[model samples]
Target chain A: MTMQNKLAWPKKITVCEVGPRDGLQNEKVLLTVEQKIELIERSVQAGAKIIEIGSFVHPKAVPQMADTDEVVKKMKRVDGVEYRALVMNLRGLERAEAVGIKKAKLTVSASPTHSLKNLNKTPEEAVRGFAECAKYAAAHGIELSGAISTAFGCCFEGRVPLEQVISVVKCFKEIGVSELSLSDTTGMANPQQVYEYSVKVREQFTDIDWVLHFHNTRGMGLSNVMAGMLAGIERYDSCFAGLGGCPFAPGASGNIATEDLVHMLSEMGIDTGYDLAEGIAIGRRVREFIGHDTDSSVLRAGRCSDIVIEQ
Target chain B: MTMQNKLAWPKKITVCEVGPRDGLQNEKVLLTVEQKIELIERSVQAGAKIIEIGSFVHPKAVPQMADTDEVVKKMKRVDGVEYRALVMNLRGLERAEAVGIKKAKLTVSASPTHSLKNLNKTPEEAVRGFAECAKYAAAHGIELSGAISTAFGCCFEGRVPLEQVISVVKCFKEIGVSELSLSDTTGMANPQQVYEYSVKVREQFTDIDWVLHFHNTRGMGLSNVMAGMLAGIERYDSCFAGLGGCPFAPGASGNIATEDLVHMLSEMGIDTGYDLAEGIAIGRRVREFIGHDTDSSVLRAGRCSDIVIEQ
Candidate 1:
């Protein structure tokens, strides 16, 4: 049966796993570099196409991600897979380049308040510095992607201007960053805002590969993903076992759980190229390894196909 | 801006709250009749147009609902609000009528295994008994609605036949019940199945007022709601603080939280007629009263508009 809707639904989509970088960073239980490597390898076995292994941030700022250099060096890399790392600036990119990393994402925040609090630089200042990283990346033969935090709304500032978000995209465009991930830093995006912004950004930047990253801080993460897909987006970023939360947004949930997102998309007949049962097992394992309860509904309640007939 | 999607969206829709009945019955904390009344009155004051105040099930079956009769008599009834209650059969319907309840819903399980375990009858036998309740309601001047639990799938039995659910609806039609609630008791429904089934049922039962009830057990509750909306169905059933889990499904979550649903809809410009801030406060209060954490995201992260600027 053909499905008709106001929006075009893609047959398949890319789900980028970022549990090691975005998820583990927020948890108090620090994982060994070996465990982080295990998580990344298992994600690849579960059919992950793009994986964000860790970040090259200041060790003092994010202690959980201090071992990024080791993780990038030791983790098993697959030939067809795109392993990504979050880099703060040119210095971080240099660190990644030293480790022979192929793909690094440059980060900025659209909310000026968030930019000041998290990066100690305004959003403008942050993107302006991306130019240097862009030049270095072009010379070094390394691929670079761009991510904008608080692209939809901000925790410190009530609402972020759409124009501010657009300006970051414009900078990324001029600096020749073709891949962009617009993230809901504090999970403040609603489906409508997401749909509108997705449509607006894609309309103007027609050649870019857009990835939507959302935090389930307020339970609208998957719904925002739905909105993004309806707006013709085909790539998303998620965490295993629902493992990430914004440090600034206290009591908020993490990124949309990879297991739950795969479950939903698969049922909708949209392929994510991930084995769900394998993913569920990994989600449960991560929660157990973390020695705490996670926010994963799939791990708690098994997939729809798991049926038990009682006497 | 005009919104266009594959489905037609209603400018406003009714959000039927079942927290008082469906939510409280699953909780270990037994609230006094006075507290139940307070919850009901507060819901009415918070712009709830339709609410399931309590149930008429046997005390042995659901001890938490044993005080339902007392709740029905003691609660302050507001004008223009449709206060609803659950009933097992004619006997339960008689009890609701004695207290002058204007509306009562008779339920049957679409899953035969669920029917045998929960109601001690098959799905076919369950609906046959509803005929008596329908006759009694018509003669007594009370309105009757039909609800098919486990309509989508069952914890005991994996996938329920779409035809079986339709047969129950046909039985309701023959008995003159026009408003029906099709509930995913096990939260085993996917968005595609929900959309296809919703469209099919509406196509066949042209005059029926369809209300979609979903559980957040597997985290697809709101996504299923989106599917139904995309299928042109309006009314939805939700619980406050995301309370209520099926006893049969071990480790499952409860219904989709009312506050979260309202938050999503209001942001999309679809009016649910509820005040979000007040709803969030009530959700937090429910968790406090029950002395446990709930599944409400808005309570934990606040609304999109609730911003706190850090120094």
Candidate 2:
């Protein structure tokens, strides 16, 4: 485990802002489609190259994301900016395609308990069911990637086995997805585990592009990001204002705060293509829009470079 | 910087909990001397080998720490457990000696502005003033360590120069202290800066033991800890319930939460010698005693290994 797994830190990284979708989906206040569009547009202005607008899911399950269609359709997409959306099945992909979402991602839980509780299917069933979604995406020329939730560990179950994660990755490979995200949906990931899993996966699937998603549920989100950076993974998923919560552990933090991540990356001399000052302002606006405080450090306390005018 | 950076992860680390002294001093409520003793005893019970009991500062300067002498005198000291107390001058050290405290720490700000504002002295003046305090400690057989506040950056002043920090370290060494702590008094430090500075100082002062102290002001506390660990630093300073507040950034977080650090370290297979459940319960009790929620991730949310029975 200590064979210099790597000390190579990425010079630059791509931050896929997931606040509009993954963040807002779990909030009590459902944002209007206009607000969602503004979120996407402002994120682009804040120098985010990729953003998850929203998810094409069943309205009953996630009422907050019911306007994903309108959000994708009404938003102004910049050329070279990747606008992604989450899809669960062929129906969801069909909806995303209908709204002209160029990138559609599918999520399956790495833990059987999570998969059954959230998707009403076991991990195997969920992975097998994604074949049709993959075929539809390939036929329609849509960029589809797979996300394995509970990749590190689960609250319902204890630790998710690395072999199980590998099997899920194999299934995603068989379905023809070139990019994948290993998500710490409940923030059960640590640095050693992240480095080990990241290295092991990169070794086994050299062809796949990896994206890391972590929750700050236990304050290890950015630490895990450091581990991933050391493991040579460059892409990460973050939420503006940290606007999500754990469904299993409610009131717990959700995703890594985007502004905080940008702040750290910029301070680390790792280019994140983000205007940290602008991003912090957007996070504040998000808090004002939601009419409640989100679990973001940058939103509560301004960026490190901020000039303290009065203190 | 691209050097392998020793990717050498330490097998175990020592967490010197500063919640009682550094944390409570910044708090509004003055915890009873009994409460302080209980906090120390319970921390040792939770497997903490070292703890900062309180400070021996003037009562008017810090009302919350006014009872520190009583706390030190009344507390039952466990053998083999290192108990530390913060002091500002010879008088404070004499008071600690009167209370039978064996270890005493003296702090000076690396930033000149902070030194003037807090201590009414320049950095050099403050460092020079420590000579008498060090002499008294040497005469009294007390283990004296130096703490440099705002070692990374200052709220009044921006980034402190690396040369200024090194000069302060040299001053501490000149004063006869063998251990020094570089504290990000306000959470303005990043992982890269931490790694570079830590490596630089360790290389320069091969005879000194270094402790990295961080606040979670911008959410980079744990990430900075990771960087320090990567830099081969095995000592850190953390608070119990993240109880401290930034005196400059009033509404911001103060120190890295102890249980959160323990949770992350334990998950990384880095032995911290903490019983996670006991530490968390103590954190909750501290919150209840303080009558407000602290800026702790693990306190708000259970540890990652905790199983959700009804979720």
- Report how far residue B4 has shifted in candidate 2, in Å: 11
Off by over 4 Å in 1: A1-8, A116-121, B1-8, B116-121
Ten-residue segment with the worst summed lDDT in candidate 2 chain A?
A: A1-10
* Sequence-dependent TM-score of model 2: 0.96
**Model 2 over residues A182-269: C-alpha lDDT tens digits?**
9998888888889888888888899999999999998889999999998889999999999778876778888999998998998878
Residue range with the least summed lDDT across 10 consecutive positions in model 1 chain B: B1-10
CAPRI-style grade of the A/B interface in model 1: medium
For every candidate, C-alpha RMSD to the true structure in Å: 2.4, 2.7
- Across B169-237, the per-residue lDDT of candidate 2 in tens digits comes to 998888899999999987899888888888888888999999999999989999999989988899999
Model 1 DockQ, alpha carbons vs. true complex: 0.53
What DockQ results do all the predictions give, each relative to the true complex? 0.53, 0.51
TM-score of chain A of each: 0.95, 0.95
Give the TM-score comparing model 1 with the true structure, all chains together: 0.95
Predicted candidate 1 versus true structure: per-residue lDDT over B123-153, tens digit per residue: 8787887888888899998888889888988
